[model samples]
Target: MDLLHTLTHRHTTKAYDTERKIPAPVVAQLLEALRYSPSSVNSQPWHFFVADNDAGKAQIAKATSSPFAFNASRVMDASHVIVLSARNTLPPEYLQTLSDQEEADGRYANADARAQAHKGRAGFVGLHEQAGDVPVWTQKQTYIAQGFLLLSAALLGVDATPMEGFDAAILSTELELAEKGLSPAVIVALGYHSDADFNARLPKSRLPEKSIFSHI
Candidate 1:
């Protein structure tokens, strides 16, 4: 599975081969992918809750919906479910250093990088307010890891469903993640596909790349 083909063929799989279960080690690799996902200034903010138990899976299934924004049974049918608990803060020391770097950049040098650094700094500062002064820049960082997870799974012949439609409160409880103040954003269901259980979804939809991009 070349990266390109894996990316192109990776569909939002709601129909999982219920009889098949994803191996534990493979799941570990997926998490590893996230663990190593790139972050701004290496502020990796992601916690993956992998649920393989029946009751747990049911809870996730009950909470989440599909990409098209529909409730899905296939969520519970997959071999495993993953929850992303992304904080909205960069590390304090990391923030401190970044702030220092900006101040130390001679006050007027390297306009592009400095501009990017400034905007990036602003983002970190904005998210800090979200986490009650805790830096939460890692939420966006986690998605980079997620991209790797999706691509890795696809290339490995595993199917996946990334879902954001769920009751965040309930999912937090089911995963016992609230104590850490971790918030749930999305759930990825993983396994092979079962044609019998397919959700009758239309093929993937998207806007044209030309419309989505522009060059100055």
Candidate 2:
């Protein structure tokens, strides 16, 4: 199927059938597709670690409040656990380039002028703050990548789920992601869906396109 139809056809498959293990090559292909996703200044501040082993899956599974209570069981049930992560610290060059471009836009003139007017003020809001917080930028990019991974997995004919209901600190410790300054953004369970999972899913919800999109 084409990208458009693939997107429409893909659903978050919660109950992966115990039918088949998702092949390693399939997961690799999904990552290859994700490589093409857009990123801030092309910094590509995200990393993905595909987990199929018991110990590795447990590390991610433990990064939750219940630490195996809810979704952890599903980890073992799926063909693979896909950890979508983002770096806490972005590349200095990415931030620098972004700041320069934003400053060039001249949105800060009034703010800068005020600070200049008052020597003691030191009152100027830097372009970074105006650009939105760093964490926000990183988080946004991660979600975008998450979308890519999900779509890529779907296109590969693999079922997947994007899950955010988990603990980052626990996951960081469990996955040794702290040294890398990375934290789990989401965990996607990939495999073929069980017949039960499909039967239990709620109908999809969406707003009309006219309401969500803008022509003006």
Candidate 3:
């Protein structure tokens, strides 16, 4: 597949064909891509809440009212909406759970290796904790996963509209994410584009390579 072509062709879908729905198999691939997204020291500190039905989508759409009302249709009319959330805090138990999963998956050679790996991951988490930016740090990781989801959608011929315009606090309350120690980070709507999507015909804008990159 021509990745560059896909990158250039994929636009943020502004309108979706509500009548159409993504196949279950394709949705599975997009979620799987998010599951394996990279993070610092493999700190997978995010959760995804998928809304495939009207009721579920309505719950997410609650956050899109008023000033964010413009995004309401994007959330409600899409075939699916994924609410990406980050862990509110990096508790020790959570870190140990990650280590245990790694061990169970045969990622560690032995107990010593497991301990060393755990310590290394904890050390990095400690830096963010000390800086009091643990929430910020985890949110950044969620964005990485979001990137994976977006690219995977494009590759699967799915149009995606990632939105940070919704009210996060309202979304958290509606989804009860805080009770689960999670904070809403971003939302992505997935579906096929509708005839009203002007972005599909517009040119992509970006700075020239020389201005945005430097090679030694």
Candidate 4:
């Protein structure tokens, strides 16, 4: 399908059919899409926690309690839920790990090239750290991955909803993310829309191009 067609048809699904599940192969492809998502300085400082089973979904549902009750059913009813997280810090070891992986993947021509790559990435990461908001910078990169996942899901004809209404702190604790140096950034629910999902019937609305875009 054309990319424009996919974008036009996709909407933030409000209700999902609990009985409908994404096939394992398709889910794997979506995961790949996220894995290959672009990030600043190629830091790739994000982790994805996918819940496709009842027990896992139940754990995520807790994040929607009380103040976040509005999105509880969206979590419980979707075929799968993905918790997007950002690393708390860009540790030196991680940059070394990326450098090693890049060399192994034949991204550099020689030792000098590899060193240069590491130095450049380290410099960029150091700048962010010095700014004293590394977590926020890392979280911004996670959103880029989220955007890729959303577009990939749309192209696959899967209904998805990007949700930020849940409690992040509760979710991080429930998912034991802090142990992994991760913090919840956002959640995405993926599945087929329910028959009662009125949001699908509503006309898609957007500002006119002239109002939102300009070319110098």
Model 3's lDDT to the true fold? 0.95
Instruction: List clashing residue pairs in candidate 1.
Output: 88-135, 88-136, 88-137, 89-135, 89-136, 89-137, 90-135
Candidate 3's C-alpha runs over 4 A off are: none
Put down candidate 3 lDDT per residue, 78-182, tens digits, no spaces.
999999999989899999999999999999888999999999999999999999999999999999999999999999999999999998889989989989999
Q: Show the lowest summed lDDT stretch of 10 residues, model 3.
A: 167-176
Candidate 4: lDDT of 157? 86
Ranking of models by lDDT = 3, 4, 1, 2
Q: Estimate each model's TM-score.
A: 0.71, 0.74, 0.98, 0.98
Instruction: State each candidate's clash count.
Output: 7, 1, 0, 0
Candidate lDDT scores, in order, read 0.71, 0.70, 0.95, 0.93
Query: Residue 148 of model 1: what lDDT?
Result: 81
Tell me how far the alpha carbon of residue 180 in candidate 4 is from the true structure, in angstroms, after superposition: 1.7
Of 1 and 2, the candidate ahead on lDDT is 1
After TM-score superposition, what is the CA distance of residue 176 in candidate 4 from its true location, in Å? 1.6
Q: Which stretches of candidate 2 lie over 4 Å from their true place?
A: 65-68, 91-132, 199-203
Q: After superposition, how far is residue 46 of candidate 4 from its true place, in Å?
A: 0.5
Alpha-carbon deviation at 166 in model 2, angstroms = 0.7
What pairs collide in candidate 3? Answer: none
Residue 119 of model 3, lDDT score: 98
lDDT of 1 by residue, 15-49 (tens): 77878998888888877877777766545566788
In candidate 4, list every pair of residues with a backbone clash. none
